[model samples]
Target chain A: MASKGTVSVEVSDLRREFKGKGSPVVALDGVSLKVGQGEIFGVLGPNGAGKTTMIRILSTLLLPTGGWAKVMGFDVEHEPEKVRRVINMASGAEKAGYDFISAKKNLWFFSQLYGIPTATAEKRIMELSEMLGLTKYLDRKFYALSTGYRQRATIARAFVNEPKVVFLDEPTIGLDVMTARSIREFLKEQARRSERTIILASHNMAEVEAICDRVAIIDKGKIIAAGTPEDLMRSLGAPALVMEVSPPQSGFEMLSRVEGVKGFTASTEEERGLSTVHIVVETDAAARAAEDAVKREGLKVVASWRKQATLEEVFVALVGRGFKEREEQDVV
Target chain B: MKARALVRLWSIFGEPLWIVVSMGFPVLSSLALSLLYYSIGAASYVGFAVLGGVMVSFWGNVLWSMASQFYWDKQEGLFEIYLTSPAPISAILIGMSVGGIIGTVPSALIVTGIGWVLFHPAVNAVWGGVILTFGLTLASLYAMGMTLSSLYLAYGREAESLNEVLQEPVSMLSGLYFPSLGARSPFPLAIQAAASLIPLTIGMDALRKTLFYGNDIWQVWPDLAILGVMAVVLLFASTYALKYLENVGRRDGTIGVRIR
Candidate 1:
């Protein structure tokens, strides 16, 4: 972690409402948070949780209907051009100038927008391409690249200006696992080695937990929870311990009645013939107490262990439903 | 940067060129109409020939310009990208107009040349200079297209419906295919008035009066005057409209929403 100043991003009660066909949708309702410099801050939420809205406002692509947000002390709405100069955004929605020019030309054009000298721009492009594995396709037309390469190109374009702050909205959405992992690693390296501030909006729990210094979970266009990933999972309590009962267990009805258990249920899929059980425990003693009951009953436990609750589990426990459930919440 | 912007301009124009090639109906209709009039042997041979040539250039210019320039941008999702960048909206729109002129210039020349070859139209050299007014007319025409494009930005999801509804009515009212100046009925009068009020139509009228009838530039000052007014007013209106639309789009959480 780098020693930073007061704040890199200070979003103060920002509000954005969208006028739908029927009622006005409150895309972001009085959302507020602060991200320190040189940190990877993640915004986690289900689809349409106003993640993109927040990123847009921060990037100066959209303005808040109420309140204010400042990037590096510059107000987004009032000083959009200044904000634009200091930051760049890459999203799945980014339409590269495909069918129009080569990727290198695209990089050169954006470099001009940042007012970088030609020599420096070329050097930066070479560096970014090498780092992102885009050198092989730099001269290719944008439409010719695969989705993974295209996204890498977009990431390179976002950093061509050496922007102080980078906003990546769903940077790894729809990517293959390996590609997503590489992108996450690249983002982490960019933040750690270059000391750049990043605000990543994503629904991928593992990616957010692995890379983020702090995660803010947004639901219904509001930040429902904010903390480090470990802190959040810890706060959600010991998540449900999942285990597979092998060797064709006929029934597990007695598993629910175990002492110290808050609640328990099990269902079997006939094709797989594996019975899965979900148990809620009153305390740490409950898991141990329930395990003993299972063994005493002479049921072989194919696998048993206490694993840390993932961000996804923590989210479901908090929201009474998963993030995707609230996607239709009036936040555009 | 200038070269890159120029390339973007070319790429956007390229899609519309395909449309112009695909739609041969309009050109055929214009030539057919010319053949009908020529076969009828209607009055003043010189007048008909020159008038017919001017009309073809006017219609060909406007139709090809509209479909190839503004329509293609809306279709390709390029407008969203154009709006998101730091480039001034006016520059992008102006660039589109320049590309449009480039795309349509060939068609206009071809259509006019065909009319001349087939009809052996008598053209007055003095009146032909009126084509220079294309510069002013194009500026105002581009502004009008941009004004409509602002509406597209504001209504992101409904952009297609809005764009589709506006094209035919605007072209018809602008009198791209007929002698709007002589229209006498109230409906036709309204169309003529609208055409005369717009810079492109006015400029086209000047070219027709001059080339076909040998009228001097001074005789067509009325049309030029209208064009000058439309240019100033439309330019300001277009700029103001786009600025307002952009601000509204930002607030509604759809600033860069892809219309296509």
Candidate 2:
């Protein structure tokens, strides 16, 4: 992958098990993948899918129970010190700064831990804070900052050392849309500007599609699919069609009976007296056939369009369930 | 590393009001105990009470700064960040211990000054031996505290309760307020022997003998040797315990967050 030295991270059959309440729970089982230098790699998974566990192991924060992982060519288990020196990670699970200290001081403290020179650290902190829209909040106590600012500061802290490899686990989980978009853009710019290898683990499919150069869909501690977004979408071998209808008729059996229309799901907006149907079809002709089938059902077709399969569709096709549904099931 | 340690010390004692209250509490407590000794016709024992106050202040530093730091760090997510960093865990612990000492030094000095002025105990003109004894006592006490911290690191909030549980008993058993020996002493020989096993007991005894009784270095060699051995043993034990617990914590996934 990427001709040896160009490979920034290489994981092989990496395994980790947690001592569950009554039995051993496998968080990761024989998960293997490789990421090249300067690549923006996205890891997609449902709840309990081992994405954070994999990031933790690779970042040298947790040791794997079996197999191996390497970061920047250093074995994570055997040469953890070297690996740690070259990497940093940001996670949404926990806030990562001293609550009593100012944001600047917190970054300074971490920079000292990384042995960054004071002058360089100061310049880097200013640059990152300015870029992340955190300059005004830099003097404020970390606990006093809002959630978005805190998340941004944590991201800035991770980048303070200009690490060769960075792991971001749901870095934008609870942010507002604008904040999340800004962070996504910043991550992309950083990856492009520095040629940094960034592994982003997130549940947001659109975010991944917008920023990731390549992605791996993980389910049940296994990498079920890995490729560029285009490659994965192309593998589905069909396009998706969206049709908006009024009066919310549900006679979609005719659409499925059509020659090229594979299947469709209809959702009604009762308050608005409208229904939107998503149909999977082999071609544009199938979409027209589905529209005709809907018209034959006496439902007024407002509009219809054929679109390429989305990453969400590809994920569902591979995993057999929608991400939110799987997440809800996990909660149950 | 040095700057980081200084920052830690500053965080603990940076506020003027906090420094006054923290240092004032031990000094005032020691003065109260000294006045009680004077009222009981044991005015000469005022120095003992003052020394006990210094040891209490030291205990506070150990409990909050060295021991409970693990819990606080985990709560603040600093422990996970520290683990993922290239810095050695020992370095962080050492920085914390050094900061603790720095934060407690003012209280210690104020108590020592009050004792020296109040009792003017028959001073060991040999200042070198007295200083060595004081230094060793602090080191041995810190080493023991560090060993206890390793156990508390696994105990989480229970460590706070244990800190309360330990305060007075350790002082009493260490002869902090009164001598554990001599004909007038109430403690049995076996009890004194058991108390002597505690580094603070031996350290306090050696300090009192050298500083108050004017004992020579040779005369206090036995206590010093015992303290030296205890310090080494506790330091080694604490180091091993920390490494073992860290590995167990990693396996259990408990190091990054609170277990309870």
Candidate 3:
């Protein structure tokens, strides 16, 4: 470990390119960022946006074609062994550990790889299994455990060494809501208790918003924005307003005409004869103005509420499109 | 260290049936081949056939148990976990090789016991040279297997097919069933030259010379020296290959690829 106050992860002009059919595809393009010790940093991006690539680089699993990155003050390229000693990663890309072995046995084997003494590893495994609600499942073979339990085992494996930095790439993908919530809570508790830097790369916006202290939105292999979740939503400079109107309003032209109402999106429910409109305004007064305009238009207001912009809205506003849209475009 | 070794050992022996098949295959082949040699009026070659059978078993262990384990671990996503650990790759391979040896011992013993009982071949009586030759042969073969694994790691799914492609050809070229020495041997000049590149050939020839021919250690120094050199060269080559291929795999985003 470096000093207590030192940056845990640092990257500058980092680039990783893969050979494509015609030319090289840049997975990471001049990406640079820093994460402080004990910080829960989130990397949010669509498919093919290089979130996994960046995690791989920082965790010493991949080499950068250009520029540099350092994890825990150890250069990833030159000091890979040192970096590996202090960091661990878990990803949803694949299930790790031997299928024939018990989950506890898998954790023990990995702890051996890290040179953790057997006694200490056993103790740690018990503690983690208890904390993650995995104690009963630890004796089951990895193949026999459910997906959620297998994922929990993988997470426990990553923390076996009590690493200074942990890289989690969508650790909760495809799990049921309760399972996902449990993992998120475990991560939050770990971050708070150990003060270990956690770099979480995920597609779950709500999960990131709930647990991450800061987040970076990456698009097209570049980070478009990085800030605290609140700061990012605030940076949008517009409060979100959701309004339900009866009679299925023909259009949202009147609300759009309201002062400081930058834009509004409307969806209609034909069965319920109701139209729901989401209006973005620059201020609270603008929200009131939009409500008055809707009322003056002779549309019955069934319900209305003012709310802060969510991270998903902030991401769409900054990236100029929804995450799924970009993912589909990239696939084509 | 102890834990890794135990895990490797348990991984193979935990299922007794796999070990039974692994050991039975070679012994059965040895019995059939020795009978064929006896029926052909080459009764004295029973020792040669037995040695070939044992060596074949060793080669099979190297290919499937040792080499293919790399592919399995990669496919199972355990390789990446191994890489992230502070343990050196060499340590892991060594543990695996030791386990493979332990798991393959029954086959070796069965072949040796059957040959001794059926043929009563002349013993060297020089246990020192025999044991030394045996150890060197295992070391060289393991080194070669490690090198092969590096290629397999890079090749991914194609590695399984490649293993099949290489198995019989290597067995033939390395004289697993027939002696490569003597002028009447069927192997041609070019074939012999190519087979010599395989460490197992050198090891098997040396082991046969020292054990069956009652030769002294010094008499087989050249063969032992060649195997030692091959072991060193292949070990270094394997290390470099593993590192280079890992980088290329990472660059191609194929490190965790499990399509096959």
Highest lDDT, which number? 3
List RMSD in Å for every model shown: 5.1, 4.2, 4.4
Candidate with best TM-score: 3
Q: Is candidate 2 or 3 superior in lDDT?
A: 3
Cα lDDT of model 1 by residue, B12-90, tens digit: 4546655466234445655776677677874334333334344444344444443344334544434444454566666
Write out the backbone clash pairs for model 1.
Answer: A27-A331
lDDT of 2 by residue, A1-332 (tens): 22223899999999999987899999899988899888899998887899988998898767899999999899988888899899988887678887666899889989988988989999999999988999999989888999999999999998998999999999999999988887888899888899889999988889899999999998878888989989888987988888899888644567657887655556788887888877777777877887888898888888887788888777666654557656766778
Q: DockQ of all candidates, in order? A: 0.33, 0.46, 0.47
Give per-residue lDDT, candidate 3, residue A190.
Answer: 86
lDDT of 3 by residue, B106-207 (tens): 778888899889877555546677788889889989988888888888775787898899898988888887777556458888888788898888777777
Mark the regions of model 3 whose C-alpha exceeds 4 Å error after superposition.
Answer: A1-5, A237-308, B1-3, B114-125, B247-260
Which CAPRI quality tier does the interface of model 2 achieve? Answer: acceptable
lDDT of 2 at B109: 90
Model 2 lDDT at residue B128:
77
iRMS values for every prediction: 3.5, 1.8, 1.8
2 versus 3: better DockQ goes to: 3
lDDT of 3 by residue, A105-198 (tens): 9899899988888899999999999989999999887889999899989899889999999999999999989988999999998888998899
lDDT of 2: 0.81
